[model samples]
Target: MNTKFEELEIKLETKQAISDLGLIDLTPIQALAIPKMIDGLDFIAEAQTGTGKTFAFAIPIIEKIKLVKETQSLVLCPTRELAIQVYNEFLKLVKYQKDILVAPIVGGESYERQFTALKKKPHIIIGTPGRIIDHLNRGTIDFSKLTQLTFDEADEMLKMGFKEDLEAILQNAPKERQTTLFSATIPQEIKRIAKEYQNNSSIIKAESETLTATKIIQNYYVVKKEDKMKLLERLLDISNMDSNIIFANTKREVDEITEFLREKKFNANSLHGDMKQKERSYVTSNFRNKQLNILVATDVAARGLDIKNVGLVINYDYPQEDEIYVHRIGRTGRAGSEGLAYTLLTPRTEHKIKQLEKFTKTTINKLEIPSEKIITKALENKLIISLKKEVVANTNTYDKIINEFEQEGISKDALLNALLDKLVPSKKVYEVIEEPKQKKSNLSDFDNKKKDRKDSNRKPSKLKDNAVLVKVNLGRKDKITPLIILDMFGSIYNIRNNNIGDIKHYQTYTVVELSSKGHSFINNKTFKYKGKNIKIEEV
Candidate 1:
């Protein structure tokens, strides 16, 4: 879909590697960074995690790695998990070249094995800051012949308090080598490193100049911390999610949530950094294959492991940092797919939500907790859709079968009722907190209708002038009078009491209008009319 990659003088092997990995195209980050990297330029790339920045550098790094080599490249990552993941990614991308080897040296592994691996004289070294520096000091790893040095998740490394170690690692590397820094943010420390280490470098900013997970509808559910588990259960039952991951702030919470879900008849597994290698692999594989519908994880454990087709990500507890929240939500809505990220927030977390909104540049819509009635309505909607799709779509065949039943003397009402019963499954009501509705105070009943008639008689004056009529499913029965509508948006949407164009209310639905603008505003949201759930959309 993008033609920019074609303009660059890229190696056939590199292009083939991308295609072999089924990455036929480039993400915005890749498109910007790859051309610069191919030019052998030192660069700093600012991006979020899960934005394909990994491959942006890996593709060029692979292209430059000589088949016959001696540790020509060194990649420093924040965590051992990320280091291992980068190494594996390099392995997958460079499948065309059999001579290249990526050795990941990190903690929690026997130093003897890493020492022996270093002895093999690998072409590339991928490691965390502390372990990489340990090897550098012991002379177990060689970087004297290194041509390129990259710091993956530079911001993360600094956040993890690895600045001094990162500096030491960089100091040991050759000054003549090219350096590439990749981070979700460009902080002062990152700039300091770039200034000291890099030459006339290019700056690739993917975050400010790219579309990211546009399909995802992000929302947060504000709940009391004590009621989070009960709310999570209700959410699971209400949302028709096929698969999901629940992230907790601690390993204890991960295990606790996993146990709670399992007890509640959900197939859930917990993964934390404390797990053994085999256990981690088993949990991840089971989750990926849908053998488990839920995975409870800590951020540290789920780092850098790619899982596909996740429909939802629940932030059971909010992350301490805004960057961590970005990474947590990034787990879902990956590879250009729609996902839902629901954060369970307490009253104290209002500031955190504000910060998140500012940092992510996306509004987190607040959703009312699912009540028994709301869940029932949602289920009915699903049933109606399924019946229309599965039963109505096959009406001809069903008609023939029903005719055969009629020959056996089955009554029409009996048959119809039976079909309806079969199509609509029974659901149990659940407990949920109720939100109070605000009542309108100013406009009188007669004045409301008169105001609507006055606006309706007025002429259109705005751009693309056209009068569009929209309807909302709320009425007098739901306590949504014309006065209520006028009061709700009085000054917030620049709507005035006299701007209301019409007023019509049936037992179940209401039709209202405004001078072009107010109609569009109300039609775009899901809101409450009195205590009832009201959905508004274009006709």
Candidate 2:
């Protein structure tokens, strides 16, 4: 336990709640941000996953909250799952202060239920920006009494294109209110928002080493993009773990991976934003209960989830940003437990491995796929364990079947061999992926230095086999966001929202991942959105 926590002079109620949770020491971010936030100064904190940023804000907010429950604090998150997570964290922190009720209002959930919750007069309401905007428009929410306003994952909210909604909410907020923002990265947009909406704010960050997932054992194997599934199959076949998460870059890929794994007899499910609330709940519950061994998800959909005991994390698709790479691997190695993470890199993405290493400040060792001998040995060991279980007084159940086989002149040895043939899969060669015989001078740099010029609106360049980075000529300057782009495509071309991969926004324009599904249709032409013709070019 750190003596600094005692110095904060936290209330007994919140302290007891913390003790009950077995939280003896404060994380660095919590230690710094908690004290400042509790002091009622506007604040900005740069925090990463697994860094205890939620508790940093929750602790201070809970301590200063009024007991009467008139909406003293409001937290806005980027996704329904994250909003719910913050709500639950608040509940835990205020366990002793029963008067401090908390509620979650997010999209994809029934508004009537939230309205009923609001009527109870929760002391704090955590919600997504859109739903909160809806409530504000309806005059159902009362921020007149709100003293503390927070934006968790502020960077993500901007990425999802909630700048206008956030701004509108800020415009309606009390100027004297204490404002706070926490994000994994402090982009220029975040800085601009702080300047516009917050008073002079103190910035806080932990030591650089504390921000990355250094505890997890990390490795990667370079493979042709087409051979990724073969590597995944080999990993699953040889792994001794109970549950794992396979992260993809897009929802379409999530479903594809899930479907492929299911066909291979692996218990897997897909989790993404497109799934209904109930469907997501069902998938998450089964995963937590160990009914599902593998979960394939995209970054946005996997946010704020706290599933435990995950033994391995697979980056099936290379993440688009450094923060995303850290977040994906941070799913494991939680709670001081040992965990392993693997990345499958293609020639186009192999460069990202170096960037990942630089960002995490750790070595990512090269991992070779299991050799045939190792695979066979693992399979034999698995079979032996099963045979051991069956040999222990289960013969009575097989008596009838054995007699039938004997009458058919099928010996026990032959029957067992046939069973083995069905249970064990045939071996195939996984092509060895060798690094380029020639390396570039900047091969070790992780920061993406070569960027398409904003003015370089030339024709689309040749992309990797199935993915294209298309630049759209509308960005934050034009009040553009990913949702607007998605909506335009959905309405105009009958395109599914998930067909595109990660949507990266710039000041004057945006870059979108046109995967095979999208590449087949996007004509590199112009389309009008909001009365302006938006042109797209290949980058």
Please, what are the lDDT tens digits per residue for candidate 2 over residues 1-539? 46445566889988888888888888889988888888898878999988888999999888888778588888999998888888888889888988778889898898899889888778888999999999999988888888899999999998877877999889887888899999999987788788888888778887778755657999888777777887788787777578999999878889999988898888999999889889998998899899988999989888988688889999997777778878888888888888898888765556667667887898999876677678778877887887789789584668799999999999999998998898775665554534434245453332233322111222232234577677777886787766787887678767675567567666567978766766655567887877998887676
- Every model's TM-score: 0.69, 0.77
Error of 2 at 500 (Å): 24
Instruction: Estimate, for each residue in 1-539, the C-alpha lDDT of model 1 and write its tens digit.
Output: 67444455666765676676666567788888887877789999987787788888887887787877588888888777788788888888777777788888987678999989999889888888888888878888888888889989898786656767988988888888989999887876688788888998667887542433666678888776668888888888777677888999778899989888888888889999679867987898888888888989987788776677788889998875677777877777766678788998765453357657877778889888888777777878877887779765674556787788899999778898997887664776555554433344465545443443443332222223454555566654566666666665573465775556555554455556655655547445776645557565554
Clashes of 1: 0
lDDT of 2 at 46: 91
Error of 1 at 191 (Å): 3.1
TM-score of 1: 0.69
Per model, state how many residue pairs clash: 0, 2
> Each prediction's Cα lDDT score?
0.75, 0.81
Considering only N, C-alpha and C atoms within 3 Å, which residue pairs clash in candidate 1? none
Where is the poorest 10-residue window by lDDT in model 2? Answer: 451-460
